[model samples]
Target: MNTNQKTIICFCEDITKEEILKAIEQGYTTANEIKRHLRAGMGECQGRGCMPQIMKLISQKTGKPREEILPPTDRAPIKPVPLGVMGKISKGNQKGV
Candidate 1:
């Protein structure tokens, strides 16, 4: 855990600043690349929270415009879903399919 890294940024995966920076240094500049390299954005929340900050860091370090960077993958269940909610949703929709 690097002291300079925000402990909460990658809370779901516990990825550290050192790891993310190492990925950036290794040419994984995009958010998706970083996610793939470190599994930073591959957790339950699907990175809806940490992605913006990650992108900002990557842009600042690589001197790339934030807009030029491709957005992170929008995996299903953008928000955290409780198990009960998931079960209810599944049951509710099963009749249609």
Candidate 2:
């Protein structure tokens, strides 16, 4: 494959290989760091589709084993919720919107 080709890693986030490389060049070498810098793994898939590619890129750029580059931490509220649900909760707690 052409090294300069724009490979899409995070389809949901529209992240590309060049973007990932730029993140690495900017010292975002770990997957989590790249995630913070580029929002590569914060899309609808939530790293499921892009993490492997991100890890591979980090490993290749940093000369670290893939396993050594830790995955981004998965936090609570793993799935998104409707705004209406949040609005209802807020209304119940306070007098005003």
Candidate 3:
């Protein structure tokens, strides 16, 4: 186990810096590859919480600009639905969707 586990990079996914580094060391250099390997930016925060730092790490490791290191596949953030809300929403949107 890596002692640096507490050094969390993706708090939403509980991903550690060591895990990201290991993924990078194992040739998962690109943002998508790193996402697939270690799930850094696939958390509830939708990469907002951790992608900056992850990109920074990648930039530092490979001498790439942080702006050049793209994040994982972008998606809408997850949100909690109240009870029965999803059913109502889907039912209302069925014709439109």
List the RMSD of every prediction in angstroms: 3.6, 4.6, 3.8
What residue pairs are clashing in model 1?
none
Best-performing candidate as measured by lDDT:
2
Q: Can you write out model 1's per-residue Cα lDDT over 1-97, one digit (the tens) per residue?
A: 6576465567789887777877899999999989988889788768877888899889988999988877777866668789898889898869763
Model 1 lDDT at residue 44: 78
Score each candidate by Cα lDDT: 0.82, 0.86, 0.79
- Cα TM-score of candidate 3: 0.73
Candidates sorted by lDDT, best first: 2, 1, 3
| Model 2 misplacement above 4 A | 1-4, 83-97
**Structural similarity to truth (TM-score) of each candidate:** 0.72, 0.76, 0.73
| Model 2 / residue 45 / CA error / Å | 1.1
Say which prediction, candidate 2 or candidate 3, comes out ahead on TM-score: 2
Which segments of model 1 are wrong by more than 4 Å? 1-8, 80-97
Q: Over the stretch 1-97, how does candidate 3's per-residue lDDT look in tens digits?
A: 8663379889978898888888888888888888777877776667778888888888888888888898777763255456597678777858864
Winner of 1 and 2 under TM-score: 2
Report how far off residue 21 is in candidate 1 (Å).
0.9
